[model samples]
Structure formats: structure tokens, C-alpha cells
Target: MITGIDHVQIAIPRGQEELARTFYGDLLGMSEIAKPAALRRRGGCWFRSGAAFLHLGVEEPFTAAAKAHPAFLVDDLDGLQSRLVEAGHECVRSDGEIEGVLRFHTYDVFGNRVEFQQLCELG
Candidate 1:
């Protein structure tokens, strides 16, 4: 039986940890978390923002994930949109058909689609 997601992983080219740190950490405000001792040698990074966790795994010949993405819940969609646009990253507003939420989509350094959403009370 399924309960909840533990974490989401995105494959990135090897030796690109710096870019991941800049995007997920500096830009998005996620804190970089240390990988376990055994996993440390593999070369990648993990990040945490509140309860959300994202793992950037090292993949040879990495291909960007175009359709599949992880949607993160946020408190202020407008503030995030401003932050992202000011940082020069394109944040495109999604044409929402989902009830009670405002959302947008953006790409990481490696072109992985990342979604941010804020829930609002439905009329």
C-alpha cells in the first residue's frame, strides 16, 4: 500500500554538483545535505527544504526529464516567481485546470522541469 513519497531523484551528468548546488541551494533556498558514507563516493548532491527532499544522482550520458516532474508546495507563489525571474530563470505560469491551486513551471540547470504550487480555498 502506498502512503507518501520519500524523495524524488533527478539524474544529472557526472561532475555537475556545483551547478546543482547553485540551482537547488542558492537559488531555491534548499539546504545541501550530506550523503551517507557509502554513497559519498558516487558524486552527486542531496537537498532539503522543509520536508521535501531532492536527490541529484550522477548519471553517465544523462538525459533531461522533460515531462515527469516533482511539484513542490509553496507558501508564496508570487514571491517565488519574483525571486526566480530576478535570478534570470524563466518561470512560466501554468494554465491551471486543477482546483484550489496556483502553479508554475521552471527548469533547472540541466533542464529538468520543476513545478511550484500554492493551495488556495476553493469557492
Candidate 2:
């Protein structure tokens, strides 16, 4: 039986490992995980933070997903949004009624959509 997700993979352009590392590691604060010996030569990187794992695989002629992306449940959504904005990235706010969730959307260097969400503040 499937217990949970092993990881979520997103494709990056060939020879863009450094950019991925900078964005996902330094910027996003995710720790880089070592790939298996066999997989190392394939050209890619893996990362983990807490229980979340994200794999960035190399793809030639890569195309970023506009609508399709992953939504992470963050502890401090406002802080992350501010960080991303201060880094010269765009942060779009959501005005929809999605229960008690507060969220924002942003894009990676590759133009892939990324969502950050947290529970709405109780007043």
C-alpha cells in the first residue's frame, strides 16, 4: 500500500544545477540531499526540508509549468512572501474564498509556479 509521497520532481534546464541550487538552497532554504551513485551521473539535484522533498531533474529544452505546481504548507507565509519579494521576485495574492487558508503565488527562476500557504489568522 502506498503510504505517502516519496518526493515531487520538477524539471530544470540542462546545465542549470548551480541556478537550481542557488534558488532552492540559498533562497528557499532547502537542504541539498545527495543523489544515488547511479543517479548522480544523470545530472540533477535533490533537496529536503522537514518532511518535504523536492527533486530537480535535468531536462533538455525544458519548459516551465505555468498552472501546474506544488503548494507547500508553510509556517510563516508572510515572511516567505516578503523574502521572495525582497529578492526581486513577484508575489501574487489570492482573493478567493478557499476556506480558512491564506496563500500567495510566486514563480521559480524557471518560471514554474509555486504556492505558499498557511492557515488564516484568527482575530
Candidate 3:
């Protein structure tokens, strides 16, 4: 039996750690966590916010994950959307297919799709 997801790994162009930090850390509100010494030489970075962990690994001739993505649960969906828009990131609102849940999709600095969602109070 499986427990839970350890982390979501995303591929990025080589030497783009600073860009990842700005997008995932400064913009997304996640904090950069040091990679293990052995893995540090591989040139990548990790970030964590609460229980959600995202790892960005360096890849040569990288291709963006435009379809596959990780959906993050947020408390303040509207506020987050506003912040992302204010920073020039487009927050594409999701269609109301899933009931009582609000979500939007946005691309990271590397063009990987990321989803943010919030549970709505069903009256």
C-alpha cells in the first residue's frame, strides 16, 4: 500500500535555479530548502510550503510539462489569483466542472502547468 506523494519533480533548463527561486519561492510563497550535499552537485533546487514539496531538477534539452501538473490546495484562492495576475502571471480560471471547488491554472517560469484550488463552503 502506498502512503503519500513525497514530492513532485519538475524538469527545468540548466542553471535556472535563480528563476525557479523567484517563481516558486518569492511568487508562490514557498521557501527554498537546501538539497542534499550529494545531490547539490546536480544543479537543482527544492521548495516547500507546509506539506507540499516541489523539486526542480536541471535537464538539458528540456521540454515543459504543459499537460501534466500538480494541483495545490490553497486557503485564499482569490487572493492568490490576484497576486499572480499582479505579477504578470496569467491565471486561467477553470470551468465549473467540479462542484464546490474553485481553481485556476497558471504556468511557471519554465512553462510547466500548475494548478491552485480552494474548497468552497457548500451551503
Candidate 4:
């Protein structure tokens, strides 16, 4: 039986590791994890924060996932949003469809859609 997700993989154009590092590492605050030796030649990078892992794989003829994305649960949603904006990333606030969830979507350097959310505390 499937218990939980191990990691989420996103496709990126080849030779963009530095860009990934700057965005996912510097901007998003995720730590880079080394890929296995066998997988090193494949040209990609991995990152982890707490229990969440994201793998960015190099793809030829790459196409960004504009519609589909990974929604990350965050603690300081407003601060993150500000950081993204100051760094020139546009944060699109979500409509109140999920109820009690404050969220926003932004595109990465490669145009992959990403979502960040924070849950509201109930009184």
C-alpha cells in the first residue's frame, strides 16, 4: 500500500543547475542534497526541507509545468511572498476556495508553477 510521497520531481532544462540553486536554494531556503553517483551523470539536483524533498531533473526539449505544481506548506507566508516579490517573482494570491488557507502561486525561473500555503489557526 502507498504510505506517503517520497519526493516530487520537476523537469528543468539541461545545464541549469546554478539557476536552480539560486532559486530553490537562495530564494526558497531549501538545502541541496547530493544525488547518487549513478544518477550524477543524469544532470540534476535535489533539495530537502524538513520532511519535504524536491528533485529537479534535467530534460531535453524541456517544457515547464505551468498548470501542475507542488503546493508547499509554509510557516511565514507573508514574509515568503515579500521575499519572492523583492526578488522579482510575482506572487499570485489564491481565491478563497480552500477555506482557512492563505496561499499564493509563483513561477520559478524556468516557469514551473509553485504554490505556498499557510493554514489559519482556529479560535
**Model 2 C-alpha lDDT per residue in residues 1-123, reported as the tens digit of each score:** 999988888888888899999888998899999999999987989999888899999887899978988778889888998899999999998835587788999999998898888887555
User: How much does candidate 3 score in TM-score?
Assistant: 0.96
lDDT of 1 by residue, 7-63 (tens): 999888899999999889998999999999999899999999999999999988899
For model 2, the superposed segments whose C-alpha errors exceed 4 Å read 121-123
Candidate 1: give the clashing pairs: none
Ranking by TM-score: 4, 3, 1, 2
Q: How does model 1 score by TM-score? A: 0.95
lDDT of each: 0.91, 0.88, 0.93, 0.95
Pairs clashing within candidate 4: none
Tens digits of per-residue lDDT, candidate 4, 7-87, equal 999999999999999999999999999999999999989999988899999989999999999999999999999999999
Clashes of 3: 0
The per-prediction tally of clashing pairs is: 0, 0, 0, 0
On lDDT, the stronger of 1 and 4 is: 4
Q: Against the true structure, whose TM-score is highest?
A: 4
